[model samples]
Each structure stands twice: as C-alpha cells, then as structure tokens.
Target: MDHHSSHFTQAFIHLDRLTHNMRLLQGLVGIRPLWPAIKANAYGHGAQIVGRHLVGLGYKTFCVAHVSEAIDLADAGLKATFIVLSATLPENSPYLVAYPCEPVVCTVEMVESLAGEAARTGKTISAHLKIDTGMGRVGIHPDAVADFLERCRNYPNVSIKGMMSHFPMADEADKSFSQQQIAQFHRTREVARSYGIRTFHFANSAAIFDLPDAHSDAVRPGISVYGLKPSHVMSNPQVDALQPVLEWKTRITFLKEVPAGTGLSYGHAFRTDRPSLIATIPLGYGDGMSRLLSNKLELLIGGVRCPQVGRICMDQCLVDVTALRGRVKLGDSVVIVGRQGREEITVDDLAQQLGTINYEIVTNIAGRVPRIPVGPSMAGASTESVGDDGTLKTLTER
Candidate 1:
C-alpha cells in the first residue's frame, strides 16, 4: 500500500526518534549490551518493523516475552540474537534451537526439558536462569536455586550463561525495596558462579534510568525507549533524552451540528446543553482505543483539544468541537496520541486519563492498525499491516 496515497487511521513509527533513543539508552547504559524488549509486539510499535529498524541501527540483541515472539522476528528475516524472558517448554525446544534465542529457565523441570531438547538436537544452547528473590511471579525460588544449579551442571549441553531477576518496584519513588532486590540478585549470582554462570542482567526500563547498580552485564529497556515514563513516579535526567516513536492519526470522516439538549453516541452518554458541532472519526474501540475512554477522553484536531463525546463506537467515535470559534469541517487530521500543529498528546497523558500505565497505552493498540515508518530510508520502506492477532506481514523492502 502506498501510505502517501491513501487516507486512513494509521500509526507512524518515527525511525529518527528510534535511532536517537537507541543511542541515548546505549550511552546511559555504558558499554553493557542493550537488549530492547520487543515483547507485546514491541509494545504495539510493530515488532517486525521495530526489529528491522533496530537491526538497521546496528542492534544485535532483542528481547521478548516468549520464544514464539522470537520466532516471529526470525521469520521476518531479522538477524539478531533473542532473549526470551519467559519459560519455554520442551515441546518448544525445536523452535528454541531453530532460532537464535536463549529462553529463561525458572524451574528444575524447565531446566531438564530445555537440556533434553539441546541434547537431542546435538547442540549447546545458552539459557538464562531467573531467580525470584522478590518478584514472586516466575523464577526458581531463592531456596531452590542451589538444587536448580545442580540440575544444570548435570547437563553440559545446556549452558547457564545468564542469571536475571525482575524488579517489581523499580519504578517506585522509594529505592529501598529495589535496592534489596538487587542485593538479593547479586548474592544469587555469586552462588551460581561457583557452577560457571557469568552473565548478569537485571535493569529493566525503570532500572536503566533509575538503578545504575542493576546495570550488570546487560540492560533490557522496554518502555523508556519509546519515550514514556515507566510510571508516573519515575523520572531522571536521562529519561528525558528518550523520544516517542509512535503517533496515532486519523482524518475526520463526518461532521454535524446538534441543537441544545441533544444526546450523542451510544446510550446517550454525552448530551449538549448549548448548540454544538460534533465531529466523527473512523476510530473506535475495535482499533484498540479502550471503550473505557468513552466520554472521558479528548482528541487533537486543528491543534485543539476536542472532547470525545458519547460512548466510543466499534468503528467510529464522536468528538465535541462546539467550542471552536470557526465551523468544524470534515477531513481534518485528528491526533489520538501524537502532535498536532503546536500541541501534542502523549502516551503518558492518555494512560493517565484511562487510569493505566504507558505500557498499556502503546501495547493495547491493535495490530490491525497498519504501521508506517517515517523518516530517512522511509522512501524505500514498505508499509506494514498487522493481523488482528498481531501477526506482522512482510514489508516489501526496496
């Protein structure tokens, strides 16, 4: 599809901002390997596209939630080593070996399964062991680390090259808890080292900017690379250096005037007291715009904030533009999450309005929305279409 030749709601990937963020993150992270987490479809920035962008920018390591995500990236012709943060089953051993991925093993059972896969495939595979010092989600319990290590030593083909842990409160204002988690992680690393594990990585998006001590062998940054604070409470000088890489834009497809006391949208959620001009755009909850946003959100049109009226429909939304001095017209560009003329809407802003985090704002954007790369090299880039299930179609590279 010729992006320049059509008009539809689309998300634009700013390649230039992505480059800047990579450099800024690398600089802040020092010489440690920087693995940008591409899980959740690269936080809805389109994993395949972002993977290509990062590869072009000379990035060698990419991180994802599951090994399947890594396979998706590999299928796209991206040449990068992938680190799967989640556990991979023995049934998935072939995929782990077929693709350049290191899956995180968190249990003794997982260790045996992955090792069996490696032995059967006649290969030595690098895998990461996650320790649950504090984050009670996934990982070998601190008490079980000793036994888990012994199991790994039994299988020489399965090398434990990396040890990592997640920080549940790294983005919080208080550093005491995060400090404790890091300390616990360091102790676990020492115990594992007696058995030969060396690589250590703990810093997530929040820690990459807030916790320098966690910046061990590698730093995995997810949200900050897209220029949104990990949480409202987290910020630093280096955090400001990152840039937003996505912009959601759509053109007004319909407009109309309503008399006083007229209700708008489904269930008449928004009713006008005075005369009003309402504008409608072809974007709705189906596009991943949360239905929860209903009457509580605002969109930018002609550089002004237009209150979203009524409940957002499945394929359309109504915005109140009655406050504008001039008449509201059709075919105007509406900014759902980006800049418009002199004003800008941010992921943080949208997240705040919806009572969520920046991560949800970007990742929730459905894959059906096509992604177009904007910046240098874009002329040679092909527009990408994401499946309803987040399957990224191949981009016709020039």
Candidate 2:
C-alpha cells in the first residue's frame, strides 16, 4: 500500500491521455454530450481514477453495465448520472431508486416496480426506454414502443427520459445491417419523441466512428474513451488520433544464465537451444497474463523485444533477455503493454497475438494489480487499489 514501495506489477493510468481521447471524441460529436461508458472498471483502466478525473473534467453522465457498478462509483464519491445499460428484474428497484441512476427499461414489470418504489419513497425515478431495433437483445420490439410508452406514462412517478437502441454489427467493414438498424431506430425515435422523450441515443463506440447519422441525441462512447479502437474496420481516419490511457509495467525480479538444452518454467514448454540469459518478472496468469501467451508472447526490456519462453506460471514467467545480457539487472524496468524507449507494445498487439479483442486484454487484468495514476494532471494524485469487489481504495493522499 506504500506508494514508494516496490510493486510486482503496476498499471499506470494516463489521465492526460484520457482527456485527449475525450476531446477527439467531442470533436466528432460536435456539441452533443458524451456519456462515457465506465463499466467494467472503465474497460479495466480503473474506473475510480477515470470516473473521478472525468468528473473534474465536467462530464455529468456515464453509462454502466449494471446498477451495482454505478453504486460502486457513487459510493466512491463520484457525483454523476449513471445510465444503467442492462435490463434488470423488478427486485433491484430499491437500489436503483436510492442511487442517482437511470435504468434502461425494456419490460413493463420493471417500470411498474420503479413507479411503485418512487411513489412510496416520495421520489421520481428517471429511466430510458429500450427498443430492440435489430440487436435482438433485451428490449421491447419496435412495434411495441408506442404501447410501452403509453403503459409507462400511466406511472407518473416514473419518467421516461430517453429512448435508446444498440448496434450489433456497426464495426463491420460492410455496414448495410448497421444502416438498416439506424433506420429502424430512427422510426422508433420519432414515435418516442412524440411521447416527450427528450433523448434518443443509438451510437456505441463503433457507431461513433463510422455512423454519423446514428449520433442521435447523445452518444455513449465506451472503448474509444479508453483509447482502444472499437474495431479494425472503422472507416474514419480520425479515430487514429485517440491515445491509449493505460500502460502495464513490471520490474525484473531475478536473472540467471541457462545453458543450451535447458528447459524453463513448468512443463518445460520452452527449451534453450543456446546459452540464454533468462529474466523472471513477478507476472503471470494470476496478473491476467494469459497462459495461452506462454511461448508466443514478447515483452519489452532495454528497448528490445524479448520472447517469453516456456509455460507462463501462475505467479511468475520467464523472459529471454539474452540480448540484454550484461545490460539487464535486478529492478530493471519491463514493459508488458507500454512503451520502452522507442519500442511500444499496445493492447491491440496483445489482442492480435491472443486472437481476442482489446477489451478482453485489459478487463482481464486481475484486481490484485495496483492501478497507479500518472500524467501531467496526476502529478500529485494518489495511487489506488481496485478491490475484488470492484471498489477502489486510495492508498495515499495527493
């Protein structure tokens, strides 16, 4: 918990880069409010750090995957409007009413429960109506939007503040399906607006980059806000301007010279063909470094790419630092997904190697790893820890 003490691995969150990404996205959306998606711990960039910084930057609203995620941030003193993005049962009405959250509504039972709770508690609950244009997810059908709105109107204490939909394939190279979804949402938006819905949002991170027309009333930019491309097929060249906000780093803990024919780590997955200098960093699958990366992953040390030889263990892994030989030493910096001198390793690089998306590469990072805030704005900011429950604790004061 000591800020000055050595850490096995630390995720350096660049607050300045987050601001840059927001500005670039703001340019794309004009004056429309960007309700950043801070769910899954801001795509594992540390939501408390990201949420607190964004609150300081004047962002009033955020989108989260569940009511509990919003409650976690609210409990951490983040004062913002959290639009709960998932459909939930009526059982969670009390927590939803207690917190400053707008639950996305797709069923009448949920709305009735919210209305009952709001009336009983002497409060008015604001919610968003979800129409399943084509996502085929948990939303009312487009044809049922009018009747749903009418039924919701019966509950005067429950206000339908917005109408929303999602895009299933907006990131694809061919966006014919996305365009059709947009048209379908547009029709429902028109009908919902007539019923006094103030906001009609239909854009996700992919739609923000490729579908300008889908940027209805407000845009929910998720992965882009954290500087990860929604997908490789985005048609806009402007998305390239976004900067990544997280850098995963660790330190060299031990070093040894292994002769030819020497095996490394568990199961002897990698065997040395020649004398090799092997360095062990206190990182492995326990820290979200996938075992699948065993013999294929490369880490950066001394500005050079070093292959991670052998099976990655649960608590440690071996990096062949043969190139650095005498140059590398104990406590030397190692880059997991960051820049070391001129060489850079990004989440996209890891995703490509693992045959997964960038989102998984970050969110998979275990909560045990400390996320240290670092940037021009974070000069005096404190280091924080994300607990297993997803609550963030400040380790030190500014």
Candidate 3:
C-alpha cells in the first residue's frame, strides 16, 4: 500500500525559526547550557526531525520525558546526552543504565536500583536529584535535600551530577509563589553545593523569561524553544520575538456549490444563508482538529479567510470558500495555522477558541500528519510544494 496516497495535511517544521528561537533563548542564558526539551515528541513537532536539526546545531544535550523516548532518539542516531525528566520506578533502571539516560531521582529505591544496574553493567550512571521546592508534585521535600544527598553517597555507581526543581506558576502575572520556590531552591542549592553537585538547573520556558535570577547553572526550555510563549502573562516583551516553527497546511480535496437554505454536514449544525461554495479538506478531529471547532474556525484559501462551516467529521471538515469561488481550485493550498499572503491564523487563535493553551494546540497535532522540515537549509533538498497556485510537486521520501 502507498502510505503517501490521499494524505493531504502536513505540519511544516521550519528549522530556521527553531534555530532562531534557540538562539534567542541562548542569548538570555549566556554560556549557561540550554537543554532544549524534546519531550512529547518535541511537543508533537516530530522529535526525529527536531532532534536531528538541533544536534546539527551543536546542541550536545536534550531533555526527554522518558528513558524510552531517549532510546528512540539515540537509536535514530541523534548523538546527545539525554536527560530523562519524569520520575520512574526501580523496574526501569536497567533501560536507564543501558542507554545514555540520566534520570531525575526522587526515591531511595530508584537510586539503589540504578546503582545495582550500573554495578552489574560495569557503567557509571549520572543522575539528577529532584527537590520538591514548591511544585508539590514529584521530588523529595526541600528540607530533605541534604539527607537525600548523604544517602546517595552510598551508591558509588549512581552519581548525582545535578540538582533540579520546577516552577508551577512561573508563567502567571503574579510571581509570589515562584519567588518563594526560587528562595527555597537557593537553600537547597547550598545543600547540593556541599554534596559536590556541579549542575543546578531550575529555569523552564516561563522562568527563562520572567525569572532571570532562576537561570541557575543550566536552563531547560520547552515551549519557548518551539517559538511559543509559556502564557499570555509573561512579563518579558522579548517573548514576543520567538518565531513559530510549525505551520499546518492542507489541500482542497473536494468542492461543490450549495443553494440557499441547504443544511450541511451531520446534525445540520450549519445551514447556508446564501448560495455558498463548500470545500472539503482532509482534516478533522481524528487528525487533531477538535470537533468543537466545527463552524467555529476559519481556514485560508487563496489568501482569503474562509469560515469552516458544518459539523467537523472524523476525517474531513468543510470550509465555506465562496469568497474565493473564482480563484480557488482543487488541490489549492489551505493554511490551517500559518500565513497566507498578508493574512494569518495562529496556534494562539485556535487555543483561545478552544479555551486552552498554545501548548495543547501544538502538541495535539495528530501523528499521521507528516512533518516536513523546511527553511534555508532545506532549499535544495527534495520537498513537495503544495501552494495556492495549484502546482503539484512530488513529495520526496525522508
């Protein structure tokens, strides 16, 4: 079977914009290592593509959510140090030891298990000690940092190279809780320092913008690295400079004219007030376009903003393209989240409509939609051109 057949939707991963965002964040941290979070499949932007590009850009370290994710990237030849971010069980110690993964530790059993695995494999496993400064989620209590460090000394094979914490409300307009967290982290920093822990990382995407003091020894930036603000309330105006790296696009698959008073789609959720030209695009809730967005969203066709009418289906949605009746055609490019001429629809717009955050909007993009890497680096490489001009270019295999 031809896997590429009938696949109309794509998320264009702009490597240039990704590099720009990384450079912008790096400038703020200044020589401090910036460990870009490639977890959740690089926030659903295709981890393989994003990891490869970042590796080429001289990023020697990356943060992933799990040891398996790190293994997958490493197996794909992404040479880098993988810092596993989430808390895991003693059962996962073997995989962690087998791979180049440094997991964040919050429990004694996990540490002992890792030590056992490292001893058995004759390899030293470097790990980070997570302190629950204020997040109230994972990690040990702040007061227990010294004891944890002391206990960790028993496991010679399990080296605690770093100490870290997370901020719960760093993106909010109010910084009181974050400030307290940072203060608490400072006290724990002394403990880590006494224990000879060299790296102490605490800054995330929002903290990178609003909490300069929390920049610690290294920074782990997630959303900001993908050119997205942590929240609308970040204090730094420089957050606005981060360029979006992903653009979702599809093509007109089918079209027809409907007379006035005609009810369209399932449940008749929408009815034509006047004669309208309806265009079908191969995108739906199944493709990560929420069904709640039915008749509540707009797509770009021939640089014109066309209202998406009717109920969104599992594999298709209808766009009322009457405005572009004379200009649009079958296979014409449709901008789902990107610029078309002077008009644009952003991920933020979709999030607002869905009563969600930009992170959800981007990360929720379905897996089937192929991510095509683009930018100056990809200029001469094979790629498909599905533009509004209706010119079809053959898609090159990755």
Candidate 4:
C-alpha cells in the first residue's frame, strides 16, 4: 500500500534523531536529572507518542503545563513522573492531588489551598516553589519568598521538593542580566535549603546550551530535546549538535497547467509570468500553516524547492511547479518542512520567513495531521501502526 494513500498531510517523527538530540542534552546537563518538558502536546509532536518513546528509553520523569496533560499521560498507561510547570488552583484543579504530579506553586494562597487539598485527601503532596527572580510572569518575588516559605511550613502534608526560577535573557548575547538571575537563583537556593528544600533547577533550553553553571540539581529542557536551538544566538554549528525530528509533508491532490499571466488562488494575488503548472496540496492555515506565509513560503516537491504562489486557502495552498512541469504529477510527495533529496526546509527557515521562533513553527502544526513515527522504535515501545488517517494506533487501541 502506498504510504501517502492515508492522510494527504503527515508529520513524520524520526525517533532516532530524537534519541540523538536527547543524548546531546544529557551531556550538556551532566549529572543533573533532565526533566524534558512535553507541554503543548510535546510541542505539537504528540505527547503520547513522544512520552511513550521516552519511557522506553529509561527516562522516568516528564513535565507538562497543566493537570489535564499529566492525566492524559496516566490515562494512556504511560507511567512516568510528571512535573506540571503551571501552578494548580486548588479550588478548580483539585485533580492535581488525585494523580501523582509535582505542581509548581508561587503564591501563598496557592500554597495554602494546595495544603488544604492535601489534608482533605489524607495524602502528602510534593510541590515545587516557583520564585520570580526576573521572568516577571509568575512566581513569588525574591524578597517575599521567606514569607511564602513560612506559610507553607504551617502544613506538614505539603512537601516542597524543588525551588526554581525562569530566566528571560538566558539566550540573549548580553550575559549580564542572565548572570544576575543566576546569582539570584543561587541565593534563593540557599534560603530554600535552610527550609529543607534541596532540589534546585533553573536552566531552560537556552541556559542548558549556554550556561553550564545554572545546571543545579535538576535541569529543564523544552525545545532543544527536539533538536532545534532555542535561539539564533546559540546557533554555532560546532557546539549545538541537535537534529530536528519533525518532517511535515503533504501529497498533491490536483495538478493543472495555466496560461502565461493567468491569475490564481483566492485574491488572484499571483499571476503566471509564464505558462506554469500549479500543484495544490492539502495544507492550509487551518492546519497551523500560518496564512501569513501566503505567497511567501516554499515547498519541496520532487526534491526541488517550489515557491508557494497566490493567497493561501483555508484548506489548501498552490505551489508553482513550472520548473518540473513534466516531472511532477498528482499524488506526488511534497515536503512542507523537511528534506527532499538534497533540498530541505528547516523550522528555522519557516521561523525566519514569519519573523517568529522555531518553537512556534513546530508547535503550530495542528493535532489533526497524523504524526507517523519514521524511525526504529525503542526496545519496549509498541510497534507503530498507522490508522486510516495516518496517526499511530496505540498498542492498546489495536
């Protein structure tokens, strides 16, 4: 059976490259336990798939954004420690205590509420205290951490296992600000230690690659584990040796020749300068292919880069295939974000075109598109089987 016969568009995940990328991260973090962040559905790579692969590799700990994401893992029978990066609202997200998850709490009320839930459930909760050193997004103020710690001391059921902070400028060229944040985290660590909190982690993807000193007892890496550098500032090829594992592809459903100067697509924004062959593939902004990329992005068909022309449609886009008019045809493969022969489209390339980051490019891929694993499975992983839509049918689902 033809592989492309299933879904018109697909995202192939290379597990071998994922393993390579993870090993590189392991080397960077040294002895610090690496908590690979799988929030945002493993950054749109399918958390269930990636999480299962990681579990087979002997990786026991993972992190997600909320209680739901962690529960999704548990429901799928993926037994691994999950660290929920976001704080839990005891009134709303009491499910955090129901499942074994480590939630990051910053405010005193959050700490108290969580303690109350722990007492109600007659269970002990292992939580992380988030301190705001500089990120300004969440976490308690450095000056007020002591007061927050004191509040937590009232509840013996709440176990503050980790104290952490986020760095906003860790990827910036100017290291001065990051240095200050690092110093602040170090001071916070000392205070937390006095209160019996010993686990400390501060390094994100950028810091893991740039700041070795910030790799305390545990380190968190989100983007780099998938093999893309967090920022261009850390893109020195020699040191950052990570391989991107995503390959977005679609199949040509229709092909037609147009007269020279013929207008095309939604707005007639593009006209054939010469007699051209237009190929329409099943990819659109609805699938997280940003409409901003209209008439600007390129696709790799037949191992040749073809320019996307005219206004992108909601369900499809047109690519000018005049260069290989006779060589291409309906049902041919087109690569939206991956290699085709010697030509390839990297997520960084897409990010540069949209004036965004590589993270958005990969994470924006819609969950509907089937993510078919394209590499060898780990020893204990389920043998992957594609459903009619090209998505992996879970071992139990089969």
Candidate 5:
C-alpha cells in the first residue's frame, strides 16, 4: 500500500482545479466555446487523464498540436470534437481524415490535397483554416485568404468548420500588438465573410484571460487549463487567483548525516557547508527534475523548505534537511512542485530560478515520473496503489 516503495516519482493532477479553471475561463469568455489545449501530454500532466477529466466537465472540443496526439485521444475513447492545430502532409492526410479528428489547414497544397481526398471518399472533411496574422508560423498568408477559401468553397466534401490565427503578443500587458493581431484577424475574417465564411476564432490562453474582445467565437486555452497563468506579462491583477493543478512529488528514499565539507553529487558542484542531514530522493533529471535546478531549488519536506544541496544527478538528488525544525526520516513525503501547507513551490518558481519558462519546466520532466490523477475519489489522500510495472492502479481495485 506504500506507493513510494515502487521507486517512481509522482505528479499528482488536481482534477477539481482543472474543472474550476475551465469554469473560470468560461466566465471570462461568456458563451464562447473553450477548447482546452492538451498538447505535450497536457503540459506533462498526462494527456488522456486530463482530456477525459475535461470531457467529463462538459467540454465539447479539445485541441492538440499534431495528428498523433489526436489519434492518442481518439484511441483513449474521447468523444469530444478534437482539432489538430497543425497541418499534415499530403501522405498523412488520409490517416488524419480516416481518424475522427479535424486538421487545421495552413497551406493551399494541404487544402487541395484534403479537399481532393474528401471528394474521393464522399465524406465531408471538417477543417479549420489557419491564417498567418503575424505569428509567422504555419498559416495561410492574409492576402491569400480569399483565394484559399475560394478553392475550397466549391469542393463538395470539405467543410470549413472554422477559421483561426495565433496572436504573437497576446501575452503582453501592452495591448497594441495583440490588438493589431486581433484587428488583422477580424479583417481576414471579414474577407472570408465577404465570400460568406463565418465561424472564426483568434484568441488563445492569453487572450482568453487578458483580452475579452479577442474572443470571436471560441478560444483555445492552452496553459490556463493547467491552472497556470498564461505568461509573465499577463501575470498581473487579473490572473493572480488561478490555482496550479500539477504537483510534483516524491518520497525520501534514505537519510544520512554527512560531515562538513563533504563533496556531493557530480563535478563536486556542492560541498556540505556544515554537518548536514541529507535526504536522498529517488528523483532526478531522468524523472523530469531539471538538471539546471541543481543546488538552486528547494523542496518542501514535512511543510518545511529544504534546499537542494548537491548537483542534480540523472536518477537521484540530495536535499539538505539539517535546518528542519522537526525530525525528518526515511519514507517521508517531499514536494518538488506543489503546495506544502501555506508554502508552495511552482513550475514558475523553478523556471524563475532556472532561467526558463513554465512550459519547459513541466514538459522536460521525464516520462519515468508516473502521473497520479487526484480527484474526489482520492479524498485528498496522497496514497494510491500503483502497479508493479509503475502504472497507477485504482485504490478500490487493490
């Protein structure tokens, strides 16, 4: 029954926070459909789990960055309308069409290929046309929007379900560039409507929280669904109340007393400043704990902050627990990226110390760390039964 004995670190996902965040997003973009972006394994919180939880919360649509991700969701029996936010090759078009997922058409060649395929199969292929409104990525040029729509308009099997664009500066507090992107999107949508094309969207997570006017018909919320703020620039009075859903944790495997001046971990980057009670945790860079966090990060042990005292190894790291006010022992719980009582350690906090972004912080966590989905079923209990092969099992089944 001791989950930590399995030698796997765990990322606990708070499903209630996920649902709450979606509701908050709905409140922000009233009546506009919210597509929870679950790309990159739902930002490393486990995609299938997050997707299923969101779908249960009445989310009708979900978005990912590639076709494979959509396939994964489909294989998991997700019945929501899934949208692939990136374009697919002509060869891959058939598979995309075959699967119950929609592709975001970004180029004329892709549009032509998909249209041709849909016509041949005698099935309506739903797609969203992506317009390049200054993101300078995969999207049709603004000037070519009309011609592109024209080519697909007569195609019998291709249905332009929606039109969308990415904002280059929507994360900024300064709304000038974001507003311009929105304006350009509106202009492009108007051009499409001149040809009688409606159902357009341009806002993403940033716009969903910061710019209400940018929410055209729907908003694709990526980061906010995980309960993190959109970006640092948008991290102001508006998003101060959002709760982070993902919690990175592990158990102390062993405790040892080290003499002062003892060299620790790789390259001797750290030496004990005094006689230290070091706790060795079975988590390291291989478990998605960043190598850059060595000696710079702190973990919450028994609700007390303990500094990482050595170079973060590939499979283990040492935390100095000498200053702890209470007795620390082996098998005690440790928190690397979540709240411990009134104290909290966040991906943003780690990113700030590591000089990276929150996205990289969570995504880089190695797959070895098993994500344990927590909800009302767990009743805030940290203990859960995981399989012998490191898969998490339901406690009731155990």
Candidate 6:
C-alpha cells in the first residue's frame, strides 16, 4: 500500500453535506420525487461518486444530459431511475436500448425512433416528453403536445413515464414569466391528460425553490443538491438553509518576500505596493480556478483573507500574505473556495467578484483536482485539504 502524505492539495467533498442538502430539497418539495441532476459530471464533482452516494441516501432517481452519462451511472451500480434530460440521437439508439436508462424525448422523430427500437428488441421503452413551454432550447412545443402524444400512444413498447419543461427565469424575484411558464405547463398537462397521461413535471432547482405549486409529480434539482441557489434573489428565505457540498482548496507551494514595486506573475499585472510576503499556490485556471479571479479574489489562508496579487496562470497564482496576522510559511494550507474558521469564501462571493453565477464557479474547477470524500470526521477535518504541490487529493483513495 502506498502511503501518500496528508499535505496534498485536493477537493474535499462533504458527502454528509450533500445528503443534508438533498434532504433539505426533499423537505422543501414535500413528497415530490427528487431527481437529482448528475449531468456535467455531477456539476464537475464526479457524477459516479455523487450519484452512488445519493442513491445510498434513498434518492431513487437521477438525471443526466446525455446517454453516456446515464450509462456511466448504470455502470457504477446505480439502479435508480436514470433519465437523460437532453435530446437523444439515432446513433445513440443501440446503447439506449442496451441500458436501463430512460431518454427525454423532445421531438416526434425521437419518439418514433425509440418506439422502433423497442419493437425490435421486444422491450418496453420508457421516456419522458420534454415540452417546450417557454425555454426554446429543447422539447416539443406545447401546441404539439396532443398530436405528439396521440401519435406515440399506439406504440406498443413505448411507456410515457414523465413530462417536463424548463423555466427560464424562476430565480428572479419577479415571478410573472415563471407563472406564465407554469400556466403553459398546466395547459400542456391538460392536453396530455386528455389521452390519459398523468406523470407531469416542470420545476428545476429554481422552480423547486420559487414555484412550489409547480411540483406536480417530480422535481429535477441540479444546483440545489450541491448547496447553491439558482440566483441571488431566490437565495433568501426559501433556500437559505441549503448546505454546499463541494469545498475547493489547495496548499501553499512556497512563500517569498518581494520588495515594494516588485512585479508579480506573467505580464506583470500586479506589482507590490509595499514590501510583502507572496505565497504561491499550485492551482490556477487549469484546475478550475478562474482566470477572471486574477487580482479579484481572496483565499482563506490560515483563517485569514489573502487577496490574489497577480494574473492567475494556468497552474499557479500568487496571494498577498503580508497583512495576515499569522506566520506565513511554505506548505501552509489555503482555502480557495470554502470556509476557513470565521473567514468563509462562498461560491456566491466568487461569482459576484467574477461577474458570473455560482454554477460556473464550482463547475469550472478542472477535473485534475481530486475530490476527497469527507466522512463522519467532518467536524475536525478542514473544509478542504491542501496538498504539497497545491493539487487537491481525495481523502479516500480512488
């Protein structure tokens, strides 16, 4: 057995926190089946790991963006309902039939293709109809709901398991557009029910938090499970109780004293105003630390806030540590994306600084950062563990 040192930079995934967030969503949705979105590799948190953990915690359904993602979870022994939330292609039909995953049918052609494959295989194909109530990205139009359902109703091997739509702006404090979308969904549901279809769904993470009335049969919660709100306006009162599960961090690689006016990093974007001790951390845009954070973000070093001093490079960034009260040294840990004592750097904080959303902040973290599973010993464990080179290492060996 290889014994790696405890000083490697790694992402610390709080599994318990993930469960807690899921439970919180469940409590909020109240009896509406929770289909945790595991797409985009569980929002770059390792979909297989997060999916397995959630399945163990009694989450019976999962959502992904593609057929391959669904197959990955299935390969990971996820026996729960795996639904692909995007349109499927004809080329993917063979795998779709081979796997137990259900596809979200968005067009008449897709429905016919699935029906054909199911007939050939002598298997009942399960699918959810995506109704384009408002968001024009995917799904069949609401007006075509009756015709599409009627056309596919005669397919012997086709089973309509669900119906869903996406809300464009449920996160806004203004609910007028959201209400219109909901009304459209209701209209579509009525059309589907004319042919005896009952499984209806439309609320995503934002909708789940903002529009409780739209939790018809199930809720596909993506960001909320990771302990993030869809928008800042929707964060208070409704989703203030959610816990963030992913905590990003890295260790300080080395520390050096620079005289006043010393230019730091490439292009010399940052220059020392006064004599200062600059600590170089081994995570940059390559590891998902945004380049936009250059000189715009702060890292929690020893529970103290240290501002980034230069342009963030592909693999490293410099943080000013002169003002920090504690003794700064090489190999000391730094919290790039989580809490350190009373100093907490939230994704929202990063988003606000970077002029983006919390989703991009967390999901943009590069795949190289090893996500360490935080177990029951979470109380004593740092929100994140820092490695020697500042590359995140998993607490549990993968």
- Index of the highest-TM-score prediction: 2
What tens-digit string does per-residue lDDT give for candidate 1 at 1-398? 43432436778888788878888888888789889998999898888778877887778898899888998778867889999898667788778877898888886676677778778878888888888878888887766777888877887878888888899899999989999988888887888888788899999989988899999999999987777778767657767767899999988898788999999888998889888888889888878899999988889988898889899998899988877748457788889999887888898888888888888888888766777777764223444545455555545553
Which one wins by lDDT: 1 or 4? 4
TM-score of each: 0.93, 0.96, 0.94, 0.94, 0.92, 0.91
Better of 1 and 3 by lDDT: 3
Candidate 6 has its poorest 10 consecutive residues by lDDT at 377-386
- How would you order the candidates by lDDT, starting with the best? 2, 3, 4, 1, 5, 6
Clashes by residue pair, model 5? 288-365, 288-366
lDDT per residue (tens digit) for residues 101-179 in model 6: 7898877677777878878888888888888877889888889888888888777577887788998888889999889
Give each model's whole-structure lDDT. 0.82, 0.89, 0.88, 0.83, 0.80, 0.79
Candidate 1 weakest lDDT stretch, 10 residues: 377-386
The best candidate by lDDT is 2
Task: Report lDDT (Cα) of residue 200, candidate 1.
Answer: 91
Residue 231, candidate 1: how far off, in angstroms? Answer: 2.3
Local accuracy of candidate 4 as per-residue lDDT tens digits, 1-398: 43432667887778898898888888877767888999887898877778888887778889899888888778778888888898667674378788878889887677677778889889888989898888988898888877778878998888999899999988888778988999988987887888888899899988888888799998999998888888878733534678988889999999998999999888799999998899989899877899999889999988999999988887899999999978998899999988899998999999999999999988888766767776776734444533434244643322
Clashing residue pairs, candidate 3? none
Give lDDT tens digits, candidate 3, residues 106-142.
9999999999999999999999999997788899998
Q: RMSD in angstroms, candidate 5?
A: 3.1
lDDT of 6: 0.79
lDDT of 5 at 328: 86
